[model samples]
Target: MSRAPLLHASPDQIAAAARRVMARCDELARVTATSGRIERVYLSPEHARVNRLAAEWMRELGMRTWQDAAGNQVGRLEPAGSSRIDQRAGGHRGPALLLGSHLDTVLDAGRYDGIVGVLMALEIVRLLRMPDAASERWTSGLPFAIEIVAFSDEEGTRFGKALLGSSAVAGTWEPAWWDLTDADGTTLHRAFLEFGLDPGRIGEAARRPDEIVAYLEAHIEQGPELDRAAEPLAVVSSIASARRFQLVVEGEARHAGGTPYDMRRDALLGASEAALAVERICAAEHHIIGTVGRFEAFPGAVNVIPGEVRFSLDLRGEFDGERDRVWGSLSQELDAIMGRRGLRWRSREVHAAPAVFCAPLLQDVLRAGITQTLPSRREEPPVIFSRAGHDGMALGAIADVGMLFLRNPDGVSHHPDEAVSAGDVAHGIRALAESVLHLAAEPAR
Candidate 1:
């Protein structure tokens, strides 16, 4: 690691940068599908609008901006004296240090979850960019180029699969995803075409390993850990390994009044037991989490017994082995409960992602950045493992990934009430900017 001195941002500069980020977030919030709530999904008109706005912002900073084949809004700032003409003519293809987060959001989402990261990246670029001799071109002093990517579809709100945008960048896009449908029955392939994208050109979005130097993202913590500690920032050690499942419990449907207690086979009751088992088993393990987010029972009539029940399970853990073990235990408990209740149960895995640890070099840089920003604190900056999924999970396949988390009040996310303090956002911007400098000081890999 390089021990070079970092150029720290002044307090006033930090505050102004943070204000710009907050205002941009509010600006993007207005371009949503829902009239009142934020709900920008993949391939939606809102997505296109945000992309245009991001591209415009990137251009304002004098960057070479474009929308990738995957619909990700990208902006690149090359080192000083780099020829823009050469870049456009395919003459420059050096590895770039990538920074950004997703632009898409879940239904009725908060403003800061992914939006802050993308905006913060822009702020960092503004802080680092300098006017060349001509005063007409913008460039950086760092050895590598800086590229900001506002990923188009990390939430998967419309297609039911997360990380679609980053997966494309990481060259991990699955062909079968094209067949996936939304609530309105529009296929992903058709949606792509309708959005003015050619499905056949999707492969052009995949970036080779050598093209990217590393990936760094600054985002809201989306948890209460930092808020509870009364801290503004933390270095993320790793993102949790996660598995999602769609489970079904089946039994015989009968008339509620005619069915005797001894003769009744209640599938809902069995499913309820299974849900409890998931909670109980995961809660017993350290750093493991289980959530039953959705549940439905067949036979909507109150007078009729439900013959089948369906539920969704979202399980995650710090370690893959521990997470899988907890899932195994939960499965056993579910089997036992169903057998005793005269019901049958089955589950289909919906999504699975392994844990992604931050690169040690990047983690050290972030720590130094935080330390520089908070010199009054005697202790080292806190380190936390993210329990939520991130685009880093997909980008990890192509380059080293690191994340700096800003405190989110009450740890609320995926809802309208999710929030972050403006002061915290200011500190986060300063720390993240310093981290970029620290990384730049290091010798080229």
Candidate 2:
């Protein structure tokens, strides 16, 4: 009957708790809102004050946190001193190991978006209650049953409902999105019963299959792949397949003093060479992507000539039949670049989703915790491809999902000077406190 072992979280104490969760997420990115296209935050009121300071930093780290009533934001961590040696090592389960992310952002986010996976799940429960690297079989035992959600709107930015609370904890929030509407039309069932909740209990916010088995997320490769491989740590493997659209071009407006540029058929000059051939065919495919973000023109005039223009593309990849053959070759190369400039087109889909792969046994425990917690930098484990998007894609529709990427040292995210480095987010939270202690103390079944 000897015990006194469970210790983990050094990498300079998860880089000083990831610089105190990036200075309390830069004081919630200088007070929340800034604009929306899935930004600033949703389910507003500064997303319930960043879900009440992520349930008060998981009850100031003694664990046992909360917020659900569909505001999500959980925070557990009870192994009761390693529950009878992880239930005699069968891994006594009761639905656990669920570290989450996404606490509303986008209009002007970035204090480590999704607030660095809720402060790396409260610094992996203060590195398993501090002993510092107990693995050759943790006897001071805490063999999994840890949690730390914080979801509540991934980035619908405000009721657009993108993975909002991982689609109500994977119940897939689709009661026709409760008569959704916005742009000041407001509706997510009258904004979740005007924020008190219970639009017929919206499927009672799912998550009950015992309570959740495994879901890890630690975002921000938000783009620029660790500043193009100056590497701060990434281990995502996948999560790409996307699609979005909206293309309208029409033509003929005349009268910038009676149109003259070659007798004008301009629709914003055929939407500038079909938005630069959809960014050169998304860099000619291979981890493909094609963005246009947004565009518009119509009689938006300083004299008028652009009858119409409207634009958008946002393609993606990592297969879904090569993201539907690069969304049908970027709509047949923007309809042959707007039919050789005759201009008259229209496309629309607005959304499509698919792609999420991580979990080769927790990416070999986050590449052996970045080679035993960062060995002077040639740590190799780099494969970034999550071109921004996740709640680990609705907890990869239940079970086996993983992600961890932190290297956005000013690369940009949603906005407000989106930065990330205080030593590359405390070295990606000491490689996510060694992937939450080797996938939450494995061996329990």
Top lDDT model = 1
Prediction 1 global C-alpha lDDT: 0.88
Summarize candidate 2's per-residue lDDT along 1-445 as a digit string, tens digits: 1111123445576667777877777676666554432345556777777778778767666555656656787866555444432422113346677886876766645567777777777776666666533332223355556777888777775555577677777777767777778789888878777777777866666775456667877877777767876777778887887877788899898888866677788888888788888888778778887888789898897987888989878787887798787667767977887778778888877667788788787777776666555666554678666876788877777777888787776467777667777777776666666666666556754
- Angstrom error at residue 374, model 1: 0.9
**TM-score, every prediction:** 0.97, 0.35
Q: What lDDT score goes with residue 381 in model 1? A: 96
lDDT of 1 by residue, 1-445 (tens): 5444366446787798899999989999999888999999999999999999999998788777878778898988776555544455112357888999999999999988899999999988877753232242334467777889999998888988999999998999999999999999999999999999889988888888898889999999988999999999999999999999999999999999999999999999889888888888888889999999999999867988899999999999999999999989888898899999999989999999999999999999999889888888889899999999999999999999999999999999999999988899988888888898898888878
CA lDDT, candidate 2, residue 247: 84
lDDT of each: 0.88, 0.71
